[model samples]
Target: MLEKHVCVLEGVMVSQDREDFFLLSNCGPKLLEQKGLALGGLGVASINIGLGGKTLVELERPAAYHTTPIFPLIRSDRKRRNKTTYWRRRSCVQDTRIVIAIEPSESDGDELDLPERCRVLKLANSVTYDRMEKSLNQLEKIVLPSSDDTPNDKFLPKLTPLVRVLMGMAQPSEKIPIQELKFFDDTLNASQKEAVRFALECPELPVYMVLQVNTYAHRSDTSTHNHNILERLLALPASQSGTKLKVTRVGHPARVMAHEGVLDATLEVKANRSDQAALAKDVKNELEATLDALSGKGKGAKGKAPRGAERRKMWEEVKALRKEYRQREGGVVRSVLSESQVVLATCHSSGGRQLRDHNFDVVIIDEATQALEAVCWIPIFKAQKLILAGDPMQLPPTILSIDKMKKAKNTGGTPEKSSTTSDKTGGR
Candidate 1:
């Protein structure tokens, strides 16, 4: 039998104090499960707008909005009532209540379409299958590079040291020098010190870091007492070679919390100032030289910027080149990996386009057991050293389909959450 999560929302549970606003609460499900209730809801009305305002029909469902909450269908023809105006996804879900978007009042003639003065409140889905699709398309274009030399190329797409170890082709051998810590805590246990030491000494060791990479360094493994390892690493050496370590956390959900905890700060953008670095000045010189060589308006073998349709596209390429020059890394070599330090990001976000721009010194996945293997692969290819920090006892990723969800109850897959290994959490 299909589970019905239907619940009536009225009286104390309902609040409609302002115009064009409708609020409902005392809902059975948690807000997280209902966040995706963006569109395709039937509005209740005076004269049967949908199934005579008697039944709610949900058909041809997409994976995006998986079985949304069953809200009460109340029929009302009152003028003050939000007349049958289904809102596009301008909604917000918080705690037990949801504030659905309401379409603005229309012209007198247009009001007739909202039969019986009632319309479904809905908005288009923002965080949906489309987001994942975009991430996939971007990933596809990136990991596979345009190689002209085929098998003979000296740079064979450069598989990271972490990737080689994962595929069992090699073992990690790179190491980083750790600086002496001025402050020491006697209360801290051996495991904590060991993990901190590992982070400090390992290649892309926790001690050194690049501001351009990630700030989710806050999300570290807690089971092995490494929760404060990142903080401790930052505390140990205030600055490397007179430059302070700069970090900025990224994530929509965690933004407010990070701010409250005093962890949210802009990445050291000034640190990337090309003027101070002198890289931008060099790039500007080279670009001017190139333009001068081709600035004769197609008179010689060297052609000028094109005309018509190709002109805009050609200038766009030039703009991109200029931007790339301004965004060069801090060290001598402009490379896929930053010359400074390690990157720590959540598994899903680690796959983001901007983060994918640079290869990482290290990629640590916290609670690795809870993530899907497919998602884990997204960041796996980007790391020089990979650390999977997880707890075996914790539950794995959720499967939505009923049949598939049932099968997952027994943990039948290879490298199951229950089989978490030392190599996974052996960051220490």
Candidate 2:
């Protein structure tokens, strides 16, 4: 059977929610029909997407709805404002009983509507398309039951005690087999080194490596971690085997250059800003020099009225130069990455898998603990022995911590209602 997954991307406006899910009911009245992968058949999982308003609630018919819940999908303050505006007067369906609660526009907004019992998984919000793709690829190996109680079959393995405790499997960690590398020190040991070397030797596939940087001086500096890691990896001693290593910074300026004729909106705009800044500085210098020269020439002149026209002309010339410079620098950088066989990737770009067709024989990951569980899996699916090297003690993955959630829910208010609800349900 094809592997299945019931991915819960918890953003307020996921891509899946944009489409009408009623389309699926065309084949069967049961939400969990022939194509559904619900386990044990007690309850079924369905794709739920919505914005702030009652319209989305009526449209999605979500399992539940709440006013106090914060949607991750809408990130911008302007968008959040728009959602509130649209939801305020939208008609609510009496039958739907869509509960809408208004709460503070902060992270605490998520607290009010916390599901008493549900697996609340979290993923990195701002990750690269490549890293996200990779994580999905690795997660593809672990089949998730669509419902809490799915019937056992070829697709649904009989739940073991350990599996039962896990509740539901997720990417990166779930996909990593028992024998794969474990959490270890910052530097690789003998076995880790040999495994990396062996995998890199595969002749037919591309060798991929990721260095996840945890320490960021600034938001932008976080992106530079991958580049630094790639540089260090390439500097490592070459193995006896004759496999060439290449590094590509996905979405980097050099990477864009390699792919001729394809223009990325993000990259194009980034290049323009850099060019414009340089052009502005150069023009300013030129204007200052022209002003100094003109002032020196007219230093002792009795009436500098004639010189005023010359100065005006010079100013116009400088202005023209500035305009010309802006135009010349507006184009995108043609090249983004180096020509090496090794690859360096960052958390942002590494969120999804960009390479395909089992191109990489061996995948190396650094700072695996800080990586998104889904993002970490992308490289694993393509490579044989995933060499995950990181310090788990430092930073954890971006996944939601149930411990933190429970603590927050109980700390501020009376936990009686939620606790009683959990007790009745026997805890999820």
Candidate 3:
């Protein structure tokens, strides 16, 4: 806690329209890892209306956009998983303005102990932590470094059967008879076919990665890339498994995700009400500032914010609007999830606690290597069977803090094995 306050808090303050932003040097890895400030993070900030001194005025005044400096690497010629980053924003310390590109700590950090006039309220850095924590709470007593000889009889069957097998629970393997593909292209390579076959037959399976997958891959033609495996497998199960039992692919990344080539309709569900609410509040504050300026109040007037009747009224309206959005999200999610068998979402996008009781027959995670193991369990726990497809060599999950990673190893950060070690129990 003391270290966070020392590092994250001790930065020069820069004033944005609605809230304060702290600018740190590029050389600071800790600051770079946990980047940006949140609007809701602003709890109770007190500012002087007329504190525009020589240097103070400069920090508060708006500046044009600029590029952040690249952190010098130890060996620039060598290959690195991630290259140095630069964001388009203004900065004073020859670096960067904290942007939305990164996420902050797990909990709301300690207060930035600035003078009363300089203090700013910053909410928790990212909703990723909040949602991740929600998922973490549901998982109980999951073990990593699993061995085949470990006693499993004591483990309860709280998760889906396939997920249990994934946890090295020693479930019986079935020989599923193959059926013709209802939708997949018949010319799949031997490895692709066998991978698809194993996914169909087994409870838990880890296969090679599909292909280069990222935000840009979503734009390119799926035929060029091989991300459609999940989509192809979705339809294959209806006929291929011979049970004629309906198979629903839970997460699709690319048309057959690279959504329409083979699979059915796609429902994109993300939790964004909190973000929407934050925007509305900012608008309210801006409107108030505008009103004060128009009513003969000078530039200094904003500092003397009284939050009178008008302010309270605007807040009420924003609260009402936020509540309405929440209601709409619930009904829309419930309706879509109920009807659509094939649901597509990235790691933590599915409504976390909302999916508590619902379990699926199969849960397939495309680009399994891209997500940290802690995040994978959110969807894994909801599955009767689990299938992972990824190439760790192409893209492995990025670790921002080496210290946190080491601490996590001892403190249960990795609740499950990655695709590599997973083969020990999950098999080919």
Candidate 4:
């Protein structure tokens, strides 16, 4: 079943006169002079008020606008005839301030209706124009759905501000929720504790965790600790019900191992292939000829020592051949990514490669506090969820320029520093 989505717009209304106004809980008033109200089929209307037209008044949601509740008249015989029922004011005067709420009478239409008169409430204070503008801007960005459909209402404008007030507002959190794990015996430090918490709390698959250790020594220690924790988790007993957990680490060592294994296997297969004997013989002859040329052997090479330029040329040719062979085969890094369930890489390594249609369920960054905010976005955009773990109070990213650092400090910004040897190595 397709779920129908409803949008609401809410704001405060300030009036100049005390004229009687009929308030509708769902839709805007039947008759009102206001601008920008025709947009989005929302009951919200913008009105210019005060001297010099500086003060602007906006009606919130029409569904929420109403008057004070009045008790039913009592019967002379002590029997009440009319039950207590909320009613909208037919007329309101100038200088009257009230809160308004509105919703769509029907989906995709300018027509709006009141929900209930009992739900409306008159506000004690009117919302300021500046405050309303700010709130409206925020609401437009956060709540409006990006759609191409246009309503036929003449009053409705290009940009429809269909804002819906959720019954229960849910606030967003800066940190990811972490679940406590009992499988590991090692006592976790403060940083480790937080990382574990995030790992457990994260519900998405293919999670990326980034740790930013400033120095090589710290990075080594942190990586080892993280690997150990992950290993312990992987070592847990299999569930009887139906659950499987897989973890893989993708670092320099892992890539090197994969590369070596691939290279060796490829060489062995080619060496044993019967059809490649001619090609092998030709390659060997060329290699021998090149080596002899570099050594100043045979015809032109029979002279004195080989020139520096000749030797360099021969070496470049050999290097090019080796690179060609590697290119023909596959890369260790690519192989590992294809097989691994969880990839653990430095920010540089993660961003260095061009990923095609490769999206992770979550990306976790450790030591995020020390990483440049720009660098963090690389992995962030590739995942559905992101987890950043780092203590900002520790060392900040290394910025090389003193002038830039000073400027950043003055503006209360953490300047990004030059990459260190460790950073370059880990990125690989």
Candidate 5:
């Protein structure tokens, strides 16, 4: 069954007096149809884009009154400035009863003619919403235009206009699953190890993290170092037969390379196990016998040598088997990510638009203090629970300009700085 979601319009409210009735006469029906809504159902005749001013007019035919009130769809002109320029050309529909004010992000300066019991919905980019919400006391709700309530596989692709429309209306879920938090310290003291052990003993999915470093080079190397610990944790239980754990690594080249090394080492260990050792011996013996027979040197061998045709066929079969084995091993490595219970990714890589549909049960961030707030939000948004490990006092985020700080202070805005320490520290 197709799910129905409640839609809400937010942002700057623009109204036109009786003199501007011509602005919305033509586009009202077309715009509503495009967004899969009925204009007449909402009693909307004309619409406008922009901010400021309020003038109401009675409609010829009002919508059928219902217990649940329906608000008008308010669209904003992308090119319109948020401040300074008043009397800007925008479109708005005329409605006499129930004035709907679309409070935009930049409507701080403009006075809104809000209804007595109007709800303020704050629309924001997924990463910026939390920071923006801290300062907004009037906000009754916060909406993420890039997110969806549907499951990851069933959700629409990100950045599509339809996705934006759907997300604007969908309600966000508040339930978060119980999970565990773990810290990975390369050189852990006894107390730290004991703490990790206690955390792991809990009845929940564990989140593992490492320490934060000042520079990207150090952080990348640390990720690699900690991955070794993760490997050991996986290997301890997997030593028993018929047990396996899948893990995915997302990070810089150094971290990935480190993970590959661990994979290779694990494969080697499996190859040398007792059961595999016996199989290897049997195969070696069979191959030796076959070679001896082909050369006419084995006991009770009748033929002088294998015919040229038979020898070629045997070689081809052997090559085919070897190729098949390599392909099977390669497939195991390639399929690890999709089947993995745990996924590891660098902050920048995690924030990629391509990963928008993915959801993690738990997220662990290492060296989080050095990470920009924006970069941190990408992973946080997708996880049910998050565990961050870092010493904020040791390595603060690097800021490039005092002018940006001044501007931020003057405008009461967040500092506009690069989200990664690597950029400021001159590391690729």
Candidate 6:
């Protein structure tokens, strides 16, 4: 017998704006149903705002009316067989897979973090979600990468635990939420945690956590620089094994690490050296100052800080020491390293770490638009399924040509060609 059941993926991209959210939840199901798809919905939330303390918005998506919720879909154990339907937003009609590219109003920045799976198709007033889907249908003729890129080697060796006790610390009154801890815990399964714990405690093997922090603070000299981000990250609370963690700023000169003994640091080689040099020098100096401030807190130092200050200082230093080295050798190299049997870089400046020997199950990239197209291919080669998320409109490729925009705008201009004078002169 044929069966039709409705499954709702609840809390998917929950937006703070109740109005905009209601549109998203209802639009899809209503459209699907009108097309004869066997889907069902209760109603466009039936509640009204009143003078009382409670608001009508609180009554939406009532638990009693809600059916069993579907969790975010993860890649199944089976290998992905087709690229066309590799990541169908939802299954339907045999001809094409539907992808909804919601371009929320610019005012909705704080609404929620859009799910990583939703690709930012474009940024234009007329390029609504439906138009974007149509554009994708036309682009179906193009080729895309396969669903997964997981390599065979998945062995994580043991690590040594650090015996170094933290010098100073201040406890926050508020409890740290489980959600924050879950960020680290959810990455690995039970067996993986056992392996990670083993590796962190193994003194012989170096283990480090990598982080990229973005501070939206403004700077006077550099228009699009993130010196504050580097500064703030240098002050974050972090602790790890005794392995010497190091922080290297992106856009720094390739040879800077070589000079500092933090060799093999990844850097994206782009134009504009003046800016890169300034940013690099700023990052290096900030790191040195942070470390000195942290180390000086416990010991006797002139103009000593109070206990609270000392605790914050120590936390920053521990974090600096726990850094895992990062090389933005562009997207490709990062991708490749993510799935290497043993991670390695060209310069064994960090000892004889080999790239080909390391491997990873997943790879994620932010601010992806700044990277060259080639860099994206590297990780696709090594990762199981690469999650590339970024605002493409924020910053585009530096090498783009004017001709590329010819068809982008709806300008009514026609191309003018030079006419030959051979009509009268018969000149060749």
Candidate 3 residue lDDT tens string, 92-203:
2212121211111110111111211111122222333334444444444343323543346332225545555655666656657667644256777777777787677664
> Stretches of candidate 1 above 4 Å error?
1-157, 171-186, 198-237, 240-243, 252-254, 258-344, 399-401, 405-428
lDDT measured at residue 131 in model 2 versus the true structure, 0 to 100:
38
**Deviating ranges (above 4 Å) for candidate 6:** 1-241, 244-254, 257-358, 372-374, 385-393, 403-428
Please identify model 2 stretches exceeding 4 Å from their true place: 1-222, 234-245, 254-340, 347-354, 398-404, 407-428
In order, candidate lDDTs are 0.37, 0.33, 0.37, 0.36, 0.38, 0.27
Predicted structure with the largest TM-score when compared to the true one:
3
CA lDDT for candidate 6: 0.27
Candidate 5 lDDT over 1-428, as tens digits, reads: 01101010011001111212333454465553454332332332221211111122122235332111123333333356322211211122223232232222222221221111221111112222222222121111223323444335332223322222323643332334335544444587765675466434432223344443445444444445446546765665453576666554543231234355454433223333324244344443444354445445556777465566776665454344333433443333334334567665655445432244577766666665565544454465555545566554544544434454566689989753442122212111
Root-mean-square deviation of every model: 18.0, 22.3, 14.7, 32.7, 27.3, 28.6
Q: Tell me the tens digit of each residue's lDDT in model 2 across 198-248.
A: 444433222233332445421223334454554554455545596534444
Cα lDDT of candidate 1 equals 0.37
Would you estimate the TM-scores of all the predictions? 0.40, 0.32, 0.46, 0.35, 0.34, 0.23
lDDT of model 6, residue 9:
7
lDDT of residue 353 for candidate 2: 22
Candidate 5 residue spans exceeding 4 A from truth: 1-244, 251-260, 263-335, 353-356, 406-428
Per-residue lDDT of model 6, residues 15-110, tens digit only: 112433454456564453443431232222221111110111111122222111111122222245321111111111112222121111221222
TM-score of 2: 0.32
